[model samples]
Target chain A: MTVEVDVTIKPKRGVADPEGENTKKALHLLGFRNVRSVKSMKTFRIELELDAETTGDAEEEAVTSAVEEMCEKLLSNPVIHDYEILIVGRQIGN
Target chain B: MTVEVDVTIKPKRGVADPEGENTKKALHLLGFRNVRSVKSMKTFRIELELDAETTGDAEEEAVTSAVEEMCEKLLSNPVIHDYEILIVGRQIGN
Candidate 1:
């Protein structure tokens, strides 16, 4: 089975987001005065090849755990960013 | 009234994703061998200020149109990326 996950990462509250700030400035320059703020986030759509026998609840749990581990290990900086993991779908892989 | 929208931008199908590729390599090196592929995307959560009286359908439509314009102008590169807009919520701003 192949499980697909989307991990969204965003700067923690009170943390500086220069990219977002820059974008807000650009929008203001472009005459989008109604724009109040912009928060930029990074999302990773990851496909994982899992054991064929794992299905249903087990598959969902397994993918969630693995993806969380990936986020803790590399995808997110816990000190500055918060991450959310969402299991999108599963497909049988040959 | 304030409308919050999330704009997700991703590389068009078949386009190269070096950041995602690098992340995959790093994950593989970190022993996440099950990772088949990773596609990275950018999301912008934009808050827009609108007339206090505009609510319901008119508000929703106005926000959507303004956000689409933003995506077309700066949030996304039309040639290599595809974009999606999601209206998240509305709030009364004092």
Candidate 2:
């Protein structure tokens, strides 16, 4: 089975988001007065090949663990960012 | 009412994604052979203030129009990138 995950990395609340701030300012300058705030984030769509025989809770645990490890090691910075992982889709026999 | 929209900007299917490539390579080096592919994207969580009285289809249309206009004007590059918008959550009042 192949598991597809979406990992969204966002700045922790109260952390500085200079890019978002700049974008908000630019939007305001452009006349979007109703715009209140903007928070920027990064997302990764990842496909992982699990054993074709893997299924049920075991498969879910395996995929979640692998994805979380990947996020901790390389995908996101733990210092100021928080990440959320969702198993969006799955393909069988891949 | 205030509408929250999540705009995801991703590289088009055939477009080059150096960041994704590098991440994939890095994961491979880190011994994650199960990683098939990775696609990186940018997301903006935007908060827009609509008229307090606006609701139903009209409110939805208004938010969609405003967000699309923002994307076209500054948020994303349409040439090499494609975007998806999702209205995840909303608040009753500003």
Ten-residue stretch with the least lDDT total in model 1 chain B: B85-94
Displacement of the residue B76 alpha carbon in candidate 2, Å: 0.8
How much is B10 displaced in model 1, in angstroms?
Answer: 1.1
Fnat, one value per model: 0.99, 0.96
- Enumerate residue pairs that collide in model 1: none
Query: Per-candidate DockQ versus the true complex?
Result: 0.81, 0.91
Model 2 chain B weakest 10-residue run by lDDT: B85-94
TM-score per model over all chains: 0.89, 0.94
Error of 2 at A42 (Å): 0.8
lDDT of 1 at B38: 98
Instruction: Give every collision pair in model 2.
Output: none
What does candidate 1's lDDT look like per residue over A8-46, in tens digits? Answer: 999999999999999999999999999999999999999
User: lDDT by residue for model 1 over B1-94, one digit each (tens)?
Assistant: 8888989999999999999999999999999999999999999999999999888899888888998899899889999999988888888974
CA displacement after TM-score superposition, residue A26 of candidate 2 (Å)? 1.0
